[model samples]
Target: MKADGEALVFYENGERVGTVPLAPLSRVFMRGDVTVSSSLLGKLGERGIGVVVLSGRKAVPTMLLGRPHNDAARRVAQYRLSLDPDFCLRFSRAIVEAKLRAQAAFLGERRESEPRSRYLLTLSLKRLSSSITAVDQQATIASLRGVEGAGAAAYFEGFADLLPERLHFCGRNRRPPRDPVNAVLSLGYTLLHAETVLALYGSGPTPSSASIMRSTSHANRWPVTWSSHCGWRSTSMH
Candidate 1:
């Protein structure tokens, strides 16, 4: 299936939803005739799981929506900024340049080593632990940019080759597949990280136990596409 399946769906009994996912899940698509109870729907929405419903032959949608996240408004604001005439012109170019430079750095480090792509995870972990000293690049642009988005974008843009673009903050939709910019925004990675953090945060039993439960529940409730969506597929979706 294509990576971004539109919305998380609920079926009459979620039978179609039960097909085991391929791996590295991303979005949940609900079909078949089923009604999500208020409580269940609310829980799904709170997870910020995008929902897409199909209509009968009548050509009317049964339901379609996105759950409002606490940070949704803030996210929306960032999108507006990304499209700003000045920002798009300046930042987009800046991002492209930064990404190129980062890829160069990553490659240079392994000039005599293995392929640049294979060493990405090692390079990423190294950078993640690298210390950051105080510095100013574009004080004005930094001030205008959203803190989270800016930091995320700058680092990933710079290290485009090393990180998976799935982790980039594309907002609304899944990051474009194989997009140099968004390779870091892979939803699968974020989901694992969140589960781990939640487990630790609970201060309950072993984090792994909670982690396992939550991850499984998450998969069942809103299975990210088990298969990585590389775009374009056959009718069989294999």
Candidate 2:
């Protein structure tokens, strides 16, 4: 990749392949054997554009934030708030409840369209509804996580029913993702995770340094790794 006046030009085997305008673009995602010139990177940084590199067969993401915010206090507050146990519990509960509700709603919608699949979808929706109630009643973050996990299992079971017969997807699988459907799902999740991290950084918080429902030891170690590699403070919890 190289800067060509107002556009970023892409090359393959010494031949020009494409050009993307710098204006109206906030970020760029590069994957697999892509070479970016220092001049183009500098230009992108000057224009406040973030760049994310997704590498390897699994598409692991590494993000480059445009510039650090001037407000140090906001980041400090975010760090402190993340350490509060009560706050973490409440935040986790809310996130889980919202996610489960959305899953139930999606299943409900699919049930309307696929009446033959109604039995499985309805069962999943009921499980999600129960999980939402359990999330609200939970006192500890660990129990809340358990509820979320159960709800996710039920939700994915129904999701498999929605896939076309050609896909042959029976359940969710990851890490290596044996089937094409699972591979696509894994890629989609990786992209979403990258986007979420970017959004968190843009909203004045470090993603690798904060923990919401994650174990304390893991949260503490993640920030160190992120900071070491990315030259930015890490905050993470999920």
What is each predicted model's overall lDDT from 0 to 1? 0.35, 0.73
Worst 10 residues of 2 by lDDT: 229-238
Q: Which candidate is the best by TM-score?
A: 2
Tell me the tens digit of each residue's lDDT in model 1 across 85-203. Answer: 56443543344234333433544454335455546535543442231111123344333233323333333433445445565533323323444232333433443333333322222
Q: Residues 74-136, candidate 2, lDDT per residue (tens digit)?
A: 889877977887877776676666677777777888899998899989888888888878887
lDDT of 2 at 7: 97
In candidate 2, how many Å is residue 17 off?
2.8
Per-candidate Cα RMSD to the true structure, in Å, reads 15.7, 5.6
What does candidate 2 score in Cα RMSD to the true structure? 5.6
